[model samples]
Target: MDVDARLRELGLELPTPMTPAGNYVPAATVGDLVYLSGAGPLRPDGSMVVGKVGDGGLDLDAAREAARLTGLQLLAALRAEIGDLGRVRRVARIFGMVNCAPGFNRTPAVIDGCSDLMVEVLGDAGRGARSAVGMAELPFDIAVEIEAVVQVST
Candidate 1:
């Protein structure tokens, strides 16, 4: 599929890639695999969707949107690193983290936001193994964060 065209078809615009907040690079390519660092719910205008999930924090829907936005952030970084997303062979795996109130266990449902977008954008190549976990807090208290590993044509 033409990934750029797909984004336009979906009316989804990728955010500008953010600089690494710490010491590490946003993505690293080892051979044909591109390992994406964790990205938060950073928006196109340089703001973040920050809050906890469940309970006294964001509702499930809001948190899910946060995950979707984070997915966009990761995509932006991936494109910046690789120059063309068309080179992607498949999305290998996803690691999603949700900042939540105490005892929130519906993490997977929230992270499905990002996962679903992957399938929507990349089709079969976007379906991949994934893990979703809850965290007491995340950097900047962003609602969701996601990291991915992708296999690409060399």
Candidate 2:
């Protein structure tokens, strides 16, 4: 299915691409690989989902949702950089980081939120290698952050 159709079927709409909060660009391409910088769970309303996971902060469910939101942001960046999601050849790799309190161990499950969306949107092309780990803190204290490497048509 077309990416737009798939998004509609999933009841999702892409948010506008976010401007960089620092000096770095949001995405860059070299050869056929598009590297997306780390993105947090910033919503369209400009509010971010902020909290650590585990202990006295957000729970796993909330963190998972945040991961999903971060994935959406990555998609927005991808669309902005390439002009077409259809040009994507494969989601090559993803690196996920979760801001959490001590003893949190469900990083992979939380990051799955992003992985699931990619697969839903791009089918087999979205399946990719991934690493999810815990962080003491993240930018804005957002529950999750993710960066991706996507291979696209040259």
After the best TM-score superposition of candidate 2, give how far the Cα of residue 57 lies from its true spot, in angstroms. 1.4
Score each candidate by Cα lDDT.
0.91, 0.93
> Model 2 TM-score?
0.97
Off by over 4 Å in 1: none
Q: Write the per-residue lDDT of candidate 1 for residues 36-76, one digit (tens) a residue.
A: 99999876678899988977769999988889988898889
RMSD of each: 0.9, 0.9
Candidate 1's C-alpha lDDT? 0.91
All candidates' TM-scores?
0.97, 0.97
RMSD of 2: 0.9
